[model samples]
Target: VAQHRANVRLWWTRSSLKEHTAGLSNANIPLFFPKLECIDNANQSHLHRLEAVVAAKCVRPGASLRSIGAADVRGLCGGWLYFRQRGGSPAGATFCKEGTCRMGCTSSAEERAALARSKQIEKNLKEDGIQAAKDIKLLLLGAGESGKSTIVKQMKIIHESGFTPEDHKQYRPVVYSNTIQSLVAILRSMPNLGISYGNNEREIDGKMVFDVIQRMEDTEPFSEELLAAMKRLWTDSGVQECFGRSNEYQLNDSAKYFLDDLDRLGAKDYQPTEQDILRTRVKTTGIVEVHFSFKNLNFKLFDVGGQRSERKKWIHCFEDVTAIIFCVAMSEYDQVLHEDETTNRMQESLKLFDSICNNKWFTDTSIILFLNKKDLFEDKIRKSPLTICFPEYAGAQEYGEAAAYIQAQFEAKNKSTTKEIYCHMTCATDTHNIQFVFDAVTDVIIANNLRNCGLY
Candidate 1:
């Protein structure tokens, strides 16, 4: 325990948290979390191809220890260390972090990355000195019920450095069902809740809006099928249905013009053509806002939908992603393998993986893969076999066996696959060993920086 405390302390010092947060002012958008999703049955991709694909999208311009938040901590051990992804997207190669930032990390590769990052930081800061900073926007994307909210919460509590327990609770802001259909249903059914031109902000107008919000208060589980149902009513010939065939009481020139583009707003998949990724499966970029900190530097994440259609729209926000977190939902395996459901989450996930490996969008990107929702198997339903072989998991090898078995299904396409891909059976519950996730995340980011600086 003393060693652990000592370790955390060392990391904190290295992060050198801002005596006063530099970028954010009191007036800026005071920590806004996107709307909570309420997915009754979110698509779960059993194959981890999404993991490899997503990691291949990270862009890290600064190659310095001071740039990465990994070098400050101590006593690193266990969990994912670093990831080595290939071919897909624009940006730097190798999304890795290390040093004190790889806190409590026991992985050898991660440790090496940390050391390299530290050396690089020392060199860069000494020669060029610090410069102006900017805020990084990260899109947190995942299917409903995949624990995007929980991961956001854990990130706030552990990775942000100075956030109080109270602040952590407010990270996701509230715990609610995060489903795509439900939110669209609310807005589509209640047109009054529309937003201005190009922002996530929403506005509620007219009487029908109140009634609709009240109805949404029921808090029932909403599914993609439901969203599809609503889409039928809202769209006719690729046009908005809110004005009811344009028979509304009145419409300004701007309102009329707005209607033309409104239907396509935030809807990545307005049309479905062959080779259209998301439309072939899940048809939207289901991303919400995510805010966290490392070394006092804020990382606002926006994880877009893993489906094909959504991938097209990610470019809008991919201008400068410091790190990318690609997640593979464990339930996707069950949904596809069991044959009980028509839409196989595993198949959809695999298709997305194929696109990532083959897509030009990820040609230069680097990122990390997350085998999320390990806690789902904690119950007897998904327990491991009695005999398994894996040293890291040791006693849990029986359980770990399932991970290896599943991993085979979604391996990356790169032959070298040189970018290390570390797999962890994560719960996404954000419980014990949760910080390890952030540690791993930061470690990868740092490693990438060091490599860029030519330190490692």
Candidate 2:
């Protein structure tokens, strides 16, 4: 029983408690703990209460041992140590005088350390509140499919350390829908390509597979039979030939990748991998704000729909934005918009960019023009002539030539002469590329902020 008292004494001593325990002994346990079962129960109860009090007062407040006062520590562990007032003597003295003891405790070195640590914690919290108030708001302004959302996703991947398992799982339905939409597009364009099941006498097997693709579209349950049909259509040399001519039809960049993995993706229990989720195409309808901290700078990135109808909402979110990341789909030079088939997508994006640049609300906002989808742009430039969209682009039919012409056009049209338009060629789906570009963008934003503050 004395050993138990010794352990309790050790605990309290390490806890920075400097109180005297003169009348406190194992034999006198019944005097203080009438309800406890035994000495063990009383000791356990005393230890638990001491721990809780210490945590609430000192430990949980980020206190160091040296910063916590001895009196406070003694109060936390005082249950095990009894104190009585002594006649005309020090309150915390160990020995008694005239059957009277008084409670008094001196501050220890550990208690002083606790006080220091508590002060440090308060200082850190204050700094954090200041940093929170100094948050930077970045707005992503682009036409639909201009890689705005992709860049936002990249920010999450880089800053938040990628999506959770649940986030990856949620993309399953989106991947499936993208696959269906791509196949439907190819099927719809088959007739225009002068190749259908009713015609195309030069390729009998192509006609059969073409008919299978149409039939699989209506099949329910997406059963193994449908999977086999799609696989047959996908693997057919003639169909493969048609897909290779991607510019002839309106197909997503993810079409070939998704088609190549029909068996796995078509599985009932299929879970989307990170790459699949990254490549999956889900059109942005409204604004999505994502907050993340990168390189000690807090960023709130806003992504809004690029269609004309959705442009009205963009004006509401433009207030106090630190910078504008204007995304231009470099690959859409020849393609028309889904919202307005009569207007070319690239032309519409250019007009929208002009409006955003000239707006008085964003006169001071730094513009970052991202010529996104470089991979698709390269392929599209090779297949489709640049002259089809902009006849005055007198550059050679080359990637660099076309890209430079487009960049020059945008730079020439930008109305914000106060801020230099920062432009970069980017593929947003590429994480490594985004990380590099984002690091550069961060430096630019920080420098710009410092320059603005200097002027103020």
Candidate 3:
């Protein structure tokens, strides 16, 4: 009976040992169960229990053998068994392996150090998450020629290092193109307007201007013959009349500005001025991202094409945006869309704004309305009637009432009572105006974001 009892005890010890070491591979035995000359047969049960605790603490789910370190084993084994024997929790307890049972061992320093490191790693992760949440993402959206791209340029000038020499050089061709294209558009519109050229002799000059438009490469500079023709045609009372009635047709806002300065534009060595860069028009085709730091806050402004065909790409940029800057050409109230002359431009802007302001993707996003091109709008309001776009208007044809009515038109598009549209009257070509408006905009953005975070 004594022999059988001894045999049962030995079998029980072997079973516990196998169960504890089951997770350790043959190659990792030395790594975790290093040779402990201090351990003896008397403490073999304690060793098995310590091994179980070490396996439980150090063998993480996805941890490989190489990631398991000796310090980790030491950290786990330091005081685990002493606490287990006393029916106490092993947490923050130290074990002594000096051939006797001792609690609160000195080797627990490693465990405390590992705990400190874990806390620091957790702290760093939290800080990174906070920073990511604070980043401001702005989406620029509106109808084409609404001055969205010009706002992007203003940001570059204000925040980034102003344009380089290469930038001036690049815009030189664009300025020339604007100058030539504006003249050709005027000449083409004359026939439709039933207006004759001021000079019957200058009809040949108009033909020369048309030829330049057909064959001129983007990089090609204006020839003296073409310059002379544009000057003569621009001076023609007939062309001037057509230009005054430009709202009836599609002409760039910069056409009059560039045509008036043909001499400087056609000079032998001309570099684009800051104002020239501001006025130059280039259609935004795809997504454009501009980053800047303002008021200690990082900003990422995204400019997407506002045309119907280009708007399909706007969805890809909808994710993670902080706000939307919806630009509307205030002057376009009297004009028609380039795509469809039958469709009024201001009405198109309203429809587009209504679609996005209440979109599912931007239900919580802030909307900023930019009533842009105030300079043109003010000038045109004095001459062209606002009744062309808003025939229901009975107010005086002055700037204040006209401007307020335009702002209200856009504001009425927001169907969400919970969402407020922050509106600004902006002249995109005026740096001071844009700078002042953006400062106010930054304040609103920061305040809204803080309120959303429950920090207000």
Best by lDDT: 3
lDDT of candidate 3 over 32-62, digit per residue (tens) = 3432221334545645444432332343222
Model 2, 1-456: lDDT tens digits are 233323333321122222232344433432322211112333465454443333323323442222334333333333233332334222234422221113444444544454345444345444443453456789888887788888988988888978888997778777866776676677667667765533344244334444545675433335575567667667665566667666655688889888899988888888888788888887777668899987777888888764557566558557568789999999989888775677888888889888888877887888999999999899779878998789987878889999999998888877654768999999998999989998998888877765443321
Of models 1 and 2, which has the larger TM-score?
2
The estimated TM-scores of all candidates read 0.41, 0.65, 0.73
Superposed by TM-score, candidate 2 places the C-alpha of residue 55 at a distance from the truth, in angstroms, of 46
**Candidate 2 local lDDT, residue 371:** 98
* Prediction 2 global C-alpha lDDT: 0.66
Which regions of candidate 2 fall more than 4 Å away from where they truly are?
Answer: 1-134, 197-222, 267-269, 313-316
Ranked candidates (lDDT, high to low): 3, 2, 1
lDDT of 2 at 140: 89
Arrange candidates, best TM-score first.
Answer: 3, 2, 1
Clashing pairs in 3: 78-95, 79-94, 79-95
In angstroms, how far off is 48's CA in candidate 3?
42
Looking at candidate 3, the ten consecutive residues that score lowest on lDDT are 8-17
Which structure is stronger by lDDT: 1 or 3? Answer: 3
